[model samples]
Target: MKLTASILLTTFLSHVWSFNGELAELECPDDCDCHYFRVNWVTDCSDSNLTRIPYNELSPNVYVLDLNDNFIKEVEPFPPDFKVRRLQLSANLMSELKKESFAGLNYLIDTDFSYNQIRRVDIDAFDDSAGLINLELQGNPLDDVEGPFVAVKSLLYLDISNCSLKRLNDRFFENVTHLATLDLSDNPLFVINNNVFDPLSSLETLKMNNCNLTRIADNAFSALRNLKNLELSGNNLYETNWGVVLENLILLEYIDLRGSGLTHLPDGMFDNNQYLRVLILAENNLAGLNIQQTIGKLQNLDTLDLSDCNLTLPLSEDAFANATKIRNLYLSGNKLFASDLLLALSPLTNLHKLSLSNCGLSHLPDTFDKFKSLQELDISHNPLNDAFVKLLAPLETLEYLNMGYSNLSHLAPDSFSKMTNMRRLILSGNDINNLEAGLFGNLTHLESLELNFCGLRRPLNATLFFNNFTYTDLTELQLAGNPLRVSKTGPLLPKQLSRLQTLDLSNCNLTFLPPEAFYHTRNITNLILSGNHFTSPNDLKFLELLPMLEILDLRYNNLTTFSPKELTLNPNVEKLKLIGNPWRCDCSVANLWDWANLEKGNLGILEGSTLTQEHVSVGKTKRKKLLICNYDTGTQPFTIVMNKTVPGRRPFLNPQRTLTATNRTWAKYVRESGCEQQPSLKRVVRSADGYVSVISEDGIKMRYAKHGPNTWSAAAINAAVVYVTLMAIIGVAFLLTKKRRAAVRMVVTADKRN
Candidate 1:
């Protein structure tokens, strides 16, 4: 009886398992793949050659369903009693969402239909669905948000970013009273109506970044009294009329208007915002700011981002005189001259961070000694020469110093000697041609050093003079954009910097690389060597040394072919940028093409074949065409020589005459010389043979050869006859003269005889 009972129990367990399996497989269409746990059923029918959602086969108990990455066009029907809480149908071919498409999904809480071809959302689509909490319709062609969502009282987060939203309607968010976050970024929203935010009373965060908004209507945020965070960054608002617009947001705490077209802040702009804490107005066109009157009003202001504001003048002495509680001040990308501006910020003795980059400042005044409490100071993109280095030598309290792009041609021997608390120092984009051996000897506390684009022609071989040093202190180093040609020196960098996380050597004229170039930097995470001329075949072996490298940027190099062996050397590389290389698109490079095709997501080729020519002619004429290498095998190679003629040509011969010979005699002499006879023979035969015969010697020779003896006989007879006739004529002329003289005497004698 016990054996029988065991058998029965075994049978019953088998039946139960089979039943559960069948239930899990139920309601799943034959074309879809489904997996189910106890309460949730996950179906993946995406890209399975389906035309529409198989709603009839959908399980009723499914809570999360993903139909994304498919070719589904329409939503026909769904399970009536389904209890779906989340549905993701992104990246599909759906063009429209009808009102009744999601009718039966009463318990749906989240819906993501992003990255679709959706052009419109019909009204009343989710009118009766009250359980909806989050709706993501981003990455669509939606021009307007006029659908009926008034019934979704539980909606808290709505993302409509990257849409075609041009104008914000007043009643667009009337039904979303409980919305806590609304993201409308990356839209063409140029206009914000006065009553745009009137209905969003419970909104805590509203993002309108990159909306191209040129104007914010007065009282636009008057009704959004409960808004705590407002992001209107990347707009065209040149002026900020805070008294008419922002004064009504009594509960506003954070505001990011950075990258806006604001040139200056009004005197009393923040006078009414008593609870405001964080304000980001960076990347604007502000040349100067005078906030003395309003500083006292913003007692709660903590973080102020004024970077890239084109501030040319120093801060007024009274600007932040009353703002004693301010902490973070981002003033990078300004036109600061020196540390004299520290006098204006002296009242804020508790300030922690300050950025003054791109400010045309060459030196820091000794007044920086006043900011003993300052922790971070970004003085990059200025003209900080050796003078500024001395000025910064005394700041012992500084923890982070960014002096990038400062045109710093030199560094004093002990410039950073007293900066004991310095942890991070950025000196990129400068003219620093050299670094003294012990330049950073005193910066024992330094953790990160960035010297990219510093015009460093040689390699760095400095050692920390301080005896209290270890391999775990320095964590990051960026030496990109330097003209360090020999890569063998790369390994000479302090091996004690074992904790380095990043090393950027891009744009360096590195032609050859040694095997141990990066052998010591085992803990490096990011390695960038883009824009370099790494022509050696063994250059790729450098990757083998960086075992921990995760991100590698090898873009814009001389890597003609991709090698899988080289890539496999760094198996941990997560992000690799191989673009901008002259990758041969031929059979020899077939492996590279295959790899690129297989890993299209990770690799990127330059837009066109050859590197873009940057130095085009500056005149109005069109650019001349460049002869790039031909990839087609059938095309023949040709060369073009641009032999530009000189602006003027020299005269063929000098006009001044060296001899007094007339034109006739010169011609006769040229003919005689060209007859191919000796110069003496030509002079001797000139009178006898006649000038014409000597000149036409070539013609006479051809005539004699053709006519043979007849030609020579005719010439000889004619010459002899002419010579005899000339002698007879001379004799007759002489006798005539004698007869005339005798006749004269005879006439005299005859006259006497007569």
Candidate 2:
């Protein structure tokens, strides 16, 4: 019932908007927030540490006013018929905008003094407000645009980007002649002379990106005749003449010129942009030009991004012979071959997305009978094999196919029998193992199937999705790094995956799941058994036959306790990933301390037990949250309690840190930090304020805090003797570069139990 008529029309518009008692007698001020939105009344004193401007007389239908981030230094004067229509004083400490500074906001239409320390903007400051139409003086220092927009003549969007603007004289937009979107990007303005945007004749979107621009003088955009999107990307614009900067953008439809180092793109430079539809010259240095004579007269060009232009132009067949109506073509990081990608994609016969990924393509010459309106094809990380899957089985209007990593191994059973409108198949990092059974039995609209790192080790044959007839719109199945085992002629998935909804068998060393694995996958909802080897929580009874399981990733599994009968299997499992498990905190982890402090499930732990180098620099930093186990029976035999969070130290010899929570108290500071028997304290480095750094097994020879029995603290023994004399001069320059490594094989075994 349309959510019960959207909850009875939201309780009859919250009782007809409380019959506007003027926003219910508008008193919300002391640290503001007054509601009533649709058609006026919104106060909200942003970040309430406000230092002013809580101006009076609001609710005359208070039209949206949010005095942004406080300590406001001055944007006062409001008190008279204050009719605000959108005004957010951004990050404040306002410095100037004097003259009638928004005199009564004549229904001010949008004004955000961006991140302010604004260095002045007097010039009749919007001359008694003439319906200000979007004005944000970006992070101001304003290197003189003189007379700050001489009265925003119906200003339609203006953001003096970064505001260190170096040039732009021709009366700097004279009087904001109906400006329509102008962001002087970053601003150093190297050059862009002539008619300097002839008073923005209705300038329609122009962002001088990065602005180190080399040149663009001639009639500088010929009066932006209703310019339609132009961003001169991060510029040095290698000798940019760009045919007098694109002749006069005949209603130019999008142009990004990414990274601009342009090696060549002049000839007819987009012959009068025949309605140029999206053209991004990606990371430019157009290797040796002739890439379709730089956008072959853009005959209504539809999306063309020359990816990482290191292109060595060999592509012939008239390159893109007049860009035959290009429909999405990004030559991913080009270095083409295979008949120069079939003569640069057989003239993009209306290509519907074609990306020759990492173009060192191993094959694909038959060029899918001229891409019959190709519908998404990315030859991922190309080195391709499996004869590029029978050369994309003649892409019968291919519906998204990405041969991921592309060193594909086997799939010959009619290799995707003429891609029956395949709906999304990415054979991930292919080394594909086995599967010949009606190979994708005529891909019945295959939904989302990614054979992630296919090294498939048997057992997954429900004819790939219930054979004997037909029914395979397989919903999102990524046999993640396949090694799908448990084979005594039993389980490895496919027990009728009744429309499986995302089932990624992560790092498959998975130790078993026979009991009807996902019993007909009752529409399994996101179940990625992360880095497997499931070690009980009763191995989660194949997720209580998945009652639409809602995300359960058992991250790096070996589970130590999530037991209370695996928390009743699917109490609407709402995301649970026990991070790199080694969990066993005794007494059966007190039944997961109130189900890991439930807030509707989202638990992931790896709190601590060893793995440090900041946990092997986990994913190069950022992934942290997942710590639970509390078990504290006030001491004696049950004490896996940790509260005074730890992980400290950092003088930066780069032993890595960043794990927080500390206030001492971990069992009375580890028995007052005596570091129990320091036989060169074999590595502790603990600290929750209770300190501990017993390290002495030749870590460049050191010792600090040596755990509290006091002695180290002369600035921690002079920062561990300047990080052990800079790791003893980089360990004697890495043992003299490993003794002039000319023939350095090894044979230095010694520790026979030390």
Question: How many clashes does each candidate structure show, in the order listed?
Answer: 3, 2
Query: How big is the RMSD of model 2?
Result: 22.7
Question: Compared with the true structure, what per-residue lDDT tens digits does model 2 show for residues 220-309?
Answer: 889887899999898987766787778888898998989877777777887887888999998888888786666776778888888878
The superposed Cα distance between candidate 1 and the true structure at residue 441, in angstroms, equals 1.7
Model 2 bad stretches (over 4 Å): 1-144, 147-216, 219-241, 245-316, 320-365, 368-412, 416-721, 726-754
| Model 1 pairs in collision | 334-359, 335-359, 336-359
Worst 10 residues of 1 by lDDT: 615-624
